[model samples]
Target: MIEINLDVVMLKRHISSKELAKRIGITQANLSILKNNKAKGIRFNTLEKICKELNCNPGDIIKRIS
Candidate 1:
């Protein structure tokens, strides 16, 4: 299974969900879905934006569990 650690990274970066979403050009609800690991998938563009804003790599926010 795949898990999203978006909230953790956001906390580390001291970024609020609303701010991140606005900066990344997404809706707060959509960000919540990703943060809560309820998203079916994420676009590369969106992921890039997220990584840029959080100053991290994809591995920093995404995990795979066996």
Candidate 2:
């Protein structure tokens, strides 16, 4: 399954969902979906923006496990 590690990153960075959303130009609702692992999919552009804003690699926020 594909897992999201956003919670970990948020903790490490001390960033709230609202703050991240603002920085990444996304809504807090959408960030909540991603945070709870309820998002069906994500756009690459959005991901890039998040990575850039968060100063983290894609791997830092995602992991694929068997």
Candidate 3:
């Protein structure tokens, strides 16, 4: 399974969900879905925006697990 570590990175960056969502040009609800690992997939454009806003890489947000 793929796990989203968005909440962890956000905390490390001292950024709030609301701010991140707005900066990434995505709805708070959609961000919540990603943060909570309820999202089935994420667009590359959206991922790029998130990485840009957080100053992090895709690996910092997602991971694979057994």
Candidate 4:
């Protein structure tokens, strides 16, 4: 399974969902879905924006488990 580690990075950066949503130009509800691993998938452009805002790589926000 793939795990979305968004909350970990958000906590590390001390950013709130509202702030991140505004920064990434996404809705807070969408960000919440992503944060809680309820998202079915994410666009690469969105991922790029998130990484840029959070100052982290994709790997920092995603992980794979067996």
As a TM-score, model 3 comes out at 0.97
* Cα lDDT tens digits for candidate 2, 14-45: 88889899999989999999988899988999
Off by over 4 Å in 2: none
Taking the tens digit of each residue's C-alpha lDDT, what string does model 1 give over 1-66? 999999999999999999999999999999999998889999999999999999999999999989
lDDT of 4: 0.97
Candidate 1 residues lying further than 4 Å off, grouped into runs, are: none
Clashing pairs in 2: none
Better of 1 and 2 by lDDT: 1
Residue-level lDDT tens digits of model 4 in 1-66: 999999999999999999999999999999999999999998999999999999999999999989
What is candidate 3's lDDT per residue for 22-45, written digit by digit as tens? 998889999999999999999999
Two-way TM-score contest, 1 vs 2, winner: 1
- What candidate 3 gets wrong by more than 4 Å, as runs, is none
Task: Return the clash pairs for model 3, or none.
Answer: none
List where candidate 4 sits over 4 angstroms from the true fold: none
Rank all candidate structures by their lDDT, best first, as comma-separated numbers. 4, 1, 3, 2
Error of 3 at 21 (Å): 0.6
